[model samples]
Target: MKIQNKRLFASILFVLISVLCVAQGPPYPGGGPPGPPGFPIDGGILMGVGVALFYGVKKILGNK
Candidate 1:
């Protein structure tokens, strides 16, 4: 068979397989979906600010 025909057949098979995969809806923990995930920038934000401040001070002082 030609390469083009092979590629076309592959594409069709892939699409059909993907459709079968999602045929059943997703399962929920309870009766409905859960709430949004939490934002985890609690201590990381302070660390990032400290690093930026240290870098800025070093640049201002012309440190090597």
Candidate 2:
């Protein structure tokens, strides 16, 4: 029971940190200043990586 509680706490902390980091990062940098509408390719690549990681974790945990 104690181990389960610790795991849950750690998961929550990890998620909170991930959310904070994402939120602190810049979004659509092009809108912030005079730019060429930001780097769409980079954004797409980042999104792809995020999706891959999400599914990879799910698969590894046998959650899917």
Candidate 3:
């Protein structure tokens, strides 16, 4: 029980940190995405980071 709680807490913390880091980080080095002028470079990069983190967390949880 304690271990499970710890794992849950750690996972939540990891996600929060990942989000904050991505949100506060610099914009993408290159110009914005191609189609329809997608989101701004910074927004695009942050979204990409968020998606990556989401998948990463999913993989980690699924594996265990």
Please report the candidate that would top TM-score against the real structure.
Answer: 1
TM-scores across all candidates? 0.41, 0.39, 0.39
Q: Across residues 1-64, which tens digit of lDDT does each residue of candidate 3 receive?
A: 6999999999999999999997874455565544565546678898999999999999999998
Model 3 residue 52 lDDT? 100
**Once superposed on the true structure, which residue ranges of model 2 sit more than 4 Å away at CA?**
27-64
| TM-score, prediction 2 | 0.39
Model 3 residue 43 lDDT? 81
Model 1 misplaced regions, further than 4 Å: 29-32, 40-64
Per-model C-alpha lDDT, please? 0.89, 0.84, 0.85
Residue by residue across 1-64, what tens digits does model 1's lDDT show? 9999999999999999999998967678664788769876688899999999999999989966
For model 2, how does the per-residue alpha-carbon lDDT over 3-55 read when each residue is reduced to its tens digit? Answer: 99999999999999999997774565754645586556768888999999999
Which candidate gets the maximum lDDT versus the true structure? 1
